[model samples]
Target chain A: TQLLEQSPQFLSIQEGENLTVYCNSSSVFSSLQWYRQEPGEGPVLLVTVVTGGEVKKLKRLTFQFGDARKDSSLHITAAQPGDTGLYLCAGRANPGGSQGNLIFGKGTKLSVKP
Target chain B: DAGVTQSPTHLIKTRGQQVTLRCSPKSGHDTVSWYQQALGQGPQFIFQYYEEEERQRGNFPDRFSGHQFPNYSSELNVNALLLGDSALYLCASSFTGTGYGYTFGSGTRLTVV
Candidate 1:
């Protein structure tokens, strides 16, 4: 079974629409990371949120870590065609003085139509 | 400096044939991790190597083995490859520091016929 699950496996929307992808898990994590991948490249780290209930904004993207540290969300405002790609969520448990290994979600495929 | 890089961008092999994949971590990083990703799915961790020694490993079978060099580059060898082993192999590098930022390579695509 997938330790972390992403919702709405696929999403397609017109330009300028708002969208949000959810990542949920039963296990608590010290940090959750968000990444975006193009067609042929590997996943690139977008941001890392350490504290629970933390919210970070990356231009049109807003990332929030759940208060319980067991879930996270990615909201994009005014998504453009350039945003079309696979968005992934990864979690790292026992962050503070431990080894860094990430558990990934299945990922949400998104498409923005112009 | 360049980011993490993997070799043999794409390869095709038949069943029972062994294959080797190589990876060179980014500058200033010491830890290396390997993951296997099938189409339309998330990556599954294979193992992690540090100081030329394996520090952690995943649930992969013995068919998957790896070695780390003094320069921090790594090589993954799959013995008695099976058709089920066809997937994209990715190498990620991370420094066990404050950031410990894990940077991934573009990946090497291996197809077993």
Candidate 2:
């Protein structure tokens, strides 16, 4: 009963390619966050999206939150080997729901080859 | 300033033994939360400590317990450890009121034999 489902659990792509990772859930969230983790390190926060149907861009990375607040996506353009890592999507339940606890997805493991 | 800090980066224990892992929250943070991540799995929330009290808990059993010190540091204790307890234990720190923008430690890898 995973609260959030992430698609393409594992991905391998060459440099300069583009890829998108999806995180879907049935329950609405107050906010969603994206993180990147390398081996032997804790996940690092990339961005946080709170408004429904909002899109945010960070250099080559683009993040979008669904209008219903139940899904999110991460798109990387011209991906480079430096983008290789585990991409995790975490959703924060609405207030008074789960005490606003964060629910995490299994994550998408990405490998960008040179 | 130092981020969250976890002790005993790695540990190996035998079944039936008790183990304690420690964490120090980031500067100015007042709340501590613990999470367990199994191999190839996402982290599952264990519990959160705020104002030296257990604020929220997940579905873990009684075998798992924790404490928060006045300085906002936390300790996670496991009683009667089982082989299945092997996993990476993470500590995240954040402000109590905001409850977001968590700062996570590298985590302690625990292996129960």
Candidate 3:
């Protein structure tokens, strides 16, 4: 089975602090997506990285895809209370692969206190 | 336009009972996918439907099955429920053949007693 390992299962930081969450896998992916989920709600797409070594920024959140397409990271700078949520990273298997689903990591729960 | 919609926001069932969850895809979407999410875990894909056919499925067993309608809506049915089946069932919709357009519903919280 294709697995994505996410680190720092839980994180709590004061406002203005910065934090980073990492997702790694041994298998290559055709694309990697980052999502943020609030309590009692489904995950909302944050960004998608399709090319290796690619980086995309959304306000204070920065996402990067590894050069090998087997890893990705989400970095939040000057975090605020609104940034607190469960962050997830999911990878789509390479086309025609046995795994056709979007394999996800357990996720990183972030709490930014003001 | 309205986003993906799921019915029966919450459900409680006993073991061995069968349950069905429904989903209506977002406007302009023709594909629907189902996922299971345990507490504190990311969603795991159960299957995907397009063109009123099962296009792909994950590692779930035959006890979990689904169907798609001509209008692109879908239904997920689970038989012989177990305690392990308790979780949030999520439905996502997107245009077929796209990798990034998935929009998920709020999810139905299922509890198997």
* Candidates ranked by TM-score: 1, 3, 2
Give lDDT tens digits, candidate 2, residues B7-90.
999999999999999999999998888989888888888998989999988889999999999999999999999999999999
- The DockQ for candidate 3, computed on C-alphas, is 0.54
Q: Return the interface RMSD of model 2.
A: 2.9
- Which of candidates 2 and 3 reaches a greater DockQ? 3
Chain A TM-score vs. truth, each candidate: 0.95, 0.94, 0.94
lDDT by residue for model 1 (B32-79), tens: 999998899888889999899988888899999999999999999999
Write candidate 3's Cα lDDT for A1-114 as tens digits.
889999999999999998999999999999899999999898899998989999999999999999999999999999999999999999988653223568889999999998
Candidate 2 Cα errors over 4 Å, as ranges: A96-99
**lDDT of candidate 2 at residue A100, scale 0 to 100:** 40
Off by over 4 Å in 1: none
Give the distance in Å from residue B104's predicted Cα in candidate 2 to where it truly belongs: 0.5
Q: Rank candidates by DockQ, best first.
A: 1, 3, 2
Please provide, for model 3 over B66-86, each residue's C-alpha lDDT reduced to its tens digit, 9 standing for 90 to 100.
999999999999999999999
